[model samples]
Target: MKLSSRRKAIAPATRPAAVKAGKCPICGKPQDAGYRPFCSKRCSDIDLGRWLGGRYAVPGEPVSTRTEEDDEE
Candidate 1:
């Protein structure tokens, strides 16, 4: 009868059919809420590993490191 209780009884609007039916980017399976955009923890871990291992990189200008020896010169 209260406003808060009425709101709680209503279910959230569902996503569009395309979004709801979209496949996981990692393994081409339907995505799960727990691991959104990916199918499972294994796929999630694989993605994380790729990032940690530098397999995924952003495009940027190369940076040169200046060492103490270079400073001496």
Candidate 2:
């Protein structure tokens, strides 16, 4: 292999590049690599709590609860 061709293959790996960091979706803060998408543990926990508490609900058809009368019928 030619030296030029070898350099071309290795050039990509040696380049110093700027990485664009993403903001947290929950808190509008710079995203942390540890938590990811959330700035801190608290924000991550808040997001989870929202999911568990049904605060973050998906748009869908409302489900009707079966009544005792409906069950008897």
Candidate 3:
């Protein structure tokens, strides 16, 4: 058997699990390869706008704004 053919036969067995191609998170439409988890440029932009507008936030302890000088004063 040819070396190339053997490699091809084994490739599928060694490959990782295929990613699920599901609906877009933004609009519930089929995802596009170009936009990925989003369906279209419009959906992708909408997601971005939400992040930039502070609609999405990561929860954490509030950061202190005062520095050493402020503490001393």
Local distance difference test values of all predictions, in order: 0.79, 0.76, 0.78
The runs of at least 3 residues in candidate 2 whose Cα sits more than 4 Å from the true structure, single-residue gaps closed, are 1-20, 55-73
Least well predicted 10-residue stretch by lDDT in candidate 3: 10-19
Best by TM-score: 3
TM-score of 1: 0.45
Q: Estimate each model's TM-score.
A: 0.45, 0.46, 0.47
Candidate 1's error at 48, in angstroms? 0.8
Q: Candidate 3, residues 3-25: lDDT per residue as tens digits?
A: 67766565455334234656688
Residue range 6-73, candidate 2, lDDT tens digits: 66565455334322566777878898889987899989999898887685566577888978788883
RMSD, one per candidate, in order: 10.0, 9.4, 9.1
- Model 3 compared with the native: what TM-score? 0.47
**Which stretches in model 3 have alpha-carbon errors above 4 Å?**
1-19, 55-73
TM-score of 2: 0.46
Model 2: weakest 10-residue lDDT segment is 10-19
